[model samples]
Target: MKISFLLHNAYGIGGTITTTFNLAQALATVGHTVEIVSVLRHRERPNFQLDPRVGLRPLVDLRQEKEHPQHLRPAKVFPAAEYRYRQYSELTDERIGACLADIDADVVVGTRPGLNVHLALQAPERVARVGQEHLTLDNHPSRLRTALRRAYRRLDVLTTVTEADAAAYRRKMRLPGVRVEALPNSVPDPALPPADGNAKLVVAAGRLVPVKRYDLLIEAFARVVAERPDWRLRIYGKGEEHDRLRALTESLGLSENVFLMGAAAPMEAEWVKGSIGAAASNFEPFGMTIVEAMRCGLPVVSTDCPYGPGEIIEDGVDGRLVPVGDAAAFGAALLELVQDDERRHRMGRSALDNARRFAPGPVVAQAERLMEEAIEARRAGRPVSQDRAPMRQILVGRGYAARDAVHATGSSALRTVRKGRR
Candidate 1:
């Protein structure tokens, strides 16, 4: 089988990029031909390690390509309501559309909303269109949700990282025959040895964004320091909230116990250095870092964030889950694991055992099944079909269609002016 993935940018670091690379590598290892089509490349090389077996084809090399006349213009095909809208342009629409039209693959998967829109509306009807939603449906703005409702009808399958999110999509969004399934991200087992459950260190990793609630983690860790002065907390990752978090740490007088470690790639080594994994996010689409920690034999203590931590962690069995935004509860959970060595070790062992379900083998098998079914359905006369009249609304009222029409009008006028000059 031949599979191609449409990505926004593979050069940057994020959960979506890491999970995509893991799945692509697993698919390639299983004797399937796989390729990743990155839409834009600002750096010479990707931040994360990509498998040698998987081919990477980037359409727009921002570092080397000359400025195009349409590079500054807004994208028509890619939905503007998407969060990454500012990064896309008319040049991307032309490039991605051309690539999709001429693509030679049985299946093409999209990793994000904007790229999914391109795959849905532009990809050849013969190829199986699978749109993978890394984030939940409700997280998107109302305008983006409306745009997706209009465009996603063409997709054969739509996958979410969690079953909770998948249910939300199936219940709220009406994509007639599209198969909405839950496909969690795959995480490969670490090469390093598992943590010994003896270290007095607690580790947390992810972007320093507000939704991650790293500040809350810091405040919670202050309680841990008050009880066990020997234990230390380290946070890895850099973002806009770095200085604010550091200031908070100093103000709390947790400067000795808390250390802000910058970003580290291939964090398996770092995971093994600590005995406990921590996540205090108020909202987590899917807790990728939490699974990484578990795979490395460190039981995570995460907040019961919507749609992720609960699904990943079997509370009190493999890991502990506290109420979201409850600093005292979070601190107490960490201290519970900190004071009791036997329970912590037992949970870490359970964590390592349980996290295997998220490993590449099982996750890849599920993905393969989805792709195979989608392909079989496409090859047959049956395809995802629904009446257009019931769903169709005024294009002018829908956000994306209206903007696309305006862009088309401007382009037409420019073409006419160029012809007159000639």
Candidate 2:
């Protein structure tokens, strides 16, 4: 079978890019003709490695910056419903439409909500239309949710990374008979040996975004440092929250103990440097780092973030899950594992064994089976009346409008500001 993946940009180094490439490579290894269709290419080549067996195609080359170099202008062909609508243009729409209209693949997979919207509208019914939701349904803004409610009716199947997320989609969206399943992101086992649980280090990774709640982690780590002066914390990845987090670390007298390692490539090597992996995000769709760290044999200590950590880590088994935003609890979990080498090592072993649930073989086979089922269901002309959204928009002509989406974000921000004032 010919399998195609549609992505917003294949050049970036992110969880979605990493997972998509992993699955595409796995499919190719199993003898399927797999291709990645990148909607936009900012660089000459993808940051992540691509398998020789898989085909790579870019629909719009943004390296030279098309008609509007800045891309701050509103979109013409790209649907306004996509979160990054302002970055697209008439050029992107034409290229994507032209490419999808004549594609002959057996299954076309879209990796994000925006690209999924295009797949839903453009892909011929002959091929199974599969949409992968890396983020949780609750994380989506109301505007995007509205658009998805309308657009996803066309998809044969939709997959989420966590069961909690899958349940949310079934309860909130109108997918009718559309099969929604929780398919964890596949992370290949590390080539090197796993962490030995001897290092006095705890590591965390991800873009330094505010939603990651590094502030909470810093505070929690300060408490850990107070108790265990020999232990240190290292945070990987760079982002806008750098200054703020750095300041917090300094003010807490943790500048010497906590180091910010910016965007380390080959994160597996970094994971092995520490005995425990930590993530204190206030909210996470799925904690890819937690799995990556576990794969390298480091027991993870993470917040019981929405929809992910609880599902990935069996509390007190492979790792420990603390309540979100609880510094004392976070610090206590860190200390418990830090103080007890025997238990940490035991959990580390269990972590390595449990992480295989996301191994390439099982994950890819699950995806393949879903694709086959979706194709069969589509071929039978199964009506989606059972779960189609009551208010489906006619997006066959005009692109999704941004007016409502902007208000959705605006209202969310307003609520946050209001809560802060209270």
Best TM-score among the predictions, by candidate number: 1
Q: Tens-digit lDDT track for model 1 on 95-196?
A: 999999999999999999989999999999799999999999999999999999999988888999987898899999988889887888888867888999
Clashes of each: 0, 1
Each prediction's whole-model lDDT (CA): 0.87, 0.82
Residue 98, model 1: lDDT of: 97
| Most accurate candidate by lDDT | 1
Off by over 4 Å in 1: 384-422
